[model samples]
Target: MGSTMFIELHAFSAGSHIRGTHIEASLIGLKRHALTNRYKMQTSINCARNSDKSYHEQHKVANLILPYPIEREEFCLCVFTTKHHISQHPQRGDRRSVLNDSQPDKNHKHRHLYFDEATITVSGGQGGDGEAWQTSKTKTVKNFKYKWGTNSQKFIELPAAEPADGGRGGNVYIRVDRACDSLLHIHKRKFWRAKKGYHGSSAPHSTPGRERPRLALTQEDLYISVPAGTVVRRKRSGELIADLTSHGMAILVAEGGAGGIAARPSQQMYSRRQKKEKEVSDVGLEISPRVTTSGEPGEVVTLQLLMRVVADIGIVGLPNAGKSSILKAITRATPDIASYPFTTLMPNLGVIHCERIVSEKLIDIDHETCALPVIADLPGLIKGAHKGRGLGRAFLRHLRRTRAMLIVVDASGQDPVSDYTTIREELRLYNPEYILRPHILALNKIDFEWAALRVQEIKAEVQSLEESAVGPAPIAVLPVSAVSGSGMDILISELMEAMRLCDEELSIVRGSAMDSRDKSDSI
Candidate 1:
């Protein structure tokens, strides 16, 4: 709430809640509806789905969320634009231009889409200034030394108190929208600012008023709400940018200024008098999102979602490495049965229910453990991924969150050595720490008759590498084919053992770190 005072009755997720307080009306006036109005803004993607043809033509507006009145469980944002939406433009030919090309291209003009620069500005409201008033009154009394008392005249000066500083401006925030319907709200407002501070009192003789500044001088407080999961980052280039990612989060975009002190009231200072003043200050808000302009048609802004799906195990392999088929076979995950590569852009999770008693044990352990070991089928990594090639870095980040990795190599082994090396290098580059985690190699496609020879070749290559290597020896490679489900039992057993090792090592490391911290604290 802003400077305006009022009782608020709000109903949250299961029940209604009410709060009664006197707030500045000005602060209330500053509040805006938290909803995004959909306007046809150029998108970020240049190509159309399944169409090579480009369009300079305009399209209907899609709805977006509006940013305002931020609070917990909600997200708010501010955006700046160099050009407004063109709602009244006439129809165009096959090749239409967003710009007014009749004249030389204005700064706002682009080929098929209007080019606009937008930024988000954020600021917190100033603090409320404290109020001061006279505490004692003056009385008149005249008295003579020897004679009776006529009455003594006593004067008391009470200094007026400065209004409380306006509440500091609300902090700027970005939230991930797990439940939010849209991000359009973020694009609605150009600036986010908190309530302003109230003014300090100028006189000391003022009457006792409300705790809030009766006069002017202090600002009210404000808040910006964002949905859960929004990544907040600073536009400024520095380490400050590093604070953005980690889960639903926010950052202090701007802080309100302190309130100014009030002046002493002009009153009789003879008898008991009030002393002290109030102070207030102002704060500014600036928030902006970086946008790239183009001469092509409107862009399609794609929010690529990266999620971790929990499972008993992850099926991972190179493109056409039978990972998709195995995921379909072992679990209910129905990934596309495609002949080409990169069919799955996102990771999918599935549960494997085994009928055997051993399977029961595995299921029980996985379900009960909050930190269950997931059998993830990580996306394929191409050579040179360690240096950020293909979908390298993104895929690697996805796997990093996983407890352990299951390397599914081709058992047909055209170059199992090279395949193994490439995968290992990428993993190391992504996180050298991951090297310590327990891992297993599954030689897939063993159903093929040549698989045995391939396995032998792989073993020889690994042995030679280990002999020449300076690091710990390589992990064991087991052959199995998803087509026939051959050797699946042995493969599963190996996985269970490897996962146990990972858990053991993890516990020791964590325990040691905790001990060190405790010692430091003790000292």
Candidate 2:
């Protein structure tokens, strides 16, 4: 006996969003329904009677099919941002996490990053075959009205109608439900592909003689649910994916196939009525990340989040520079105050309430936005940061987006002057524009016993460079004790002054450029 059709599961592509709920809009012009009660009853009985069981034993035994399997025809919305390159392998390998191009992380690894419980590839159903039949009956013998006396013959012939294409394969879908949290569904599967078309019948046959059911190709839809503010990113290029701000917004990725040729109608049935079954228009795929209310950052998946635009002043220096300690003293925000480098990954924001003397001037208001700003604790830059050594470019990129830069140098380091130059050079390499931003030098750790002597030497060196160079090396070299909370007020004041000066210079440049343009136009 021929075996029942064995269903195959397709792997949804990475970054494809699968929905947990059904999409009513895409179902238009298609027949989507569960089996009738009686049909379902018979199917359950037959399934239970069968002794041989396979992977889908429970689902088959119950005859509980999904009413609308293709929830949304779209998956993989980020595909447009990705640059495609032809390759022999069907699966894609990510270069950032895995070094080797040949190895792809198991599909289930990034489940936490997606919005839906599953991501799957959908295929269309196969069409049924057609059949042909004929009948021959004659009464003759050149007799009168009573032909019963004459000889009569009758025969029937039937033509073979080829089977219509297998009902196109069922489309794949990714479903997200309230019970799920991560994208654990994709882990179990590899890739998703639609079902192939079935062959046509050998001969013409009507309804009863037809061997298969009439199946219009139906596309499989995939859906996923991720956290709100979850950024969807293109896998290969490491670019920002979708910023899923809304709950139900879906993005389309891939489309399904068109239907094959239809059967011919008979000429003899002049008065017969005919109906046309709509073909499977297309299949769609989309990968969307869900937006969640949780403030906690989501797990790292394909992309990296660099908090640049969010923060203003980034506190950076050598180990033991007291960057974290200073941050605690300035703002109520609690960053671990330890004499160590790499203390903070997330930036801390603080409000610097202006003192009586500072708040009196109009310029002070302008300084507030630029000077007293949200500070970020960036990983310290070592000698080789420009070349991407020791969290090099990553740290620098974070600083690049800041309006101003702050160098928290160690007062007791062997060479504070050299440290400042090293940092400036690295910044220049990362972005030449960084040099244009107003920056200051803060000699921290002044409470250390040896810091007095070191602070003097460093201040002299910086002052001497200021005299020799056309412009100042930095506005001033202020000594600060992060432990004792000393010199913070003065440092804040200096930052305000520098911001005011920078703003004035910017205004002057804009005015001069505009004036020059007017002069040219007049001439």
Alpha carbon lDDT of residue 196, candidate 2?
37
Model 1 weakest 10-residue run by lDDT: 291-300
The best candidate by lDDT is: 2
Clash count of each predicted structure: 107, 74
lDDT of 1 by residue, 1-523 (tens): 2232222211112111111111122122213212221211322212112121222122211112111112334422222121212111122211111221122221112221111112355655544443333322343333334343545334344443432222232333344434442233433343555655543332233354533333342344344444322333444432232222334454545666544232223332211022211111123322111111111111111121122333344555677777766666555567776767766655655554344414535433443453334455655677766676765665565555555556777778577777766676667767786555556677788888888667777777766765222123445677778778776666655666666676788899999999999999999
On residues 92-160, what C-alpha lDDT tens digit does candidate 2 reach at each position? Answer: 432112112232223322322221223233233332222111221222233234355465433323343
For candidate 2, the 10 contiguous residues with the lowest summed lDDT are 287-296
Which runs of model 1 end up more than 4 angstroms from their true locations? Answer: 1-168, 175-235, 240-317, 324-337, 346-359, 363-370, 374-378, 429-431, 456-464, 467-476, 483-496, 514-523
For each candidate in turn, the TM-score is: 0.50, 0.44
Q: In angstroms, how far off is 240's CA in candidate 1?
A: 4.8
On TM-score, the candidate that comes out on top is 1
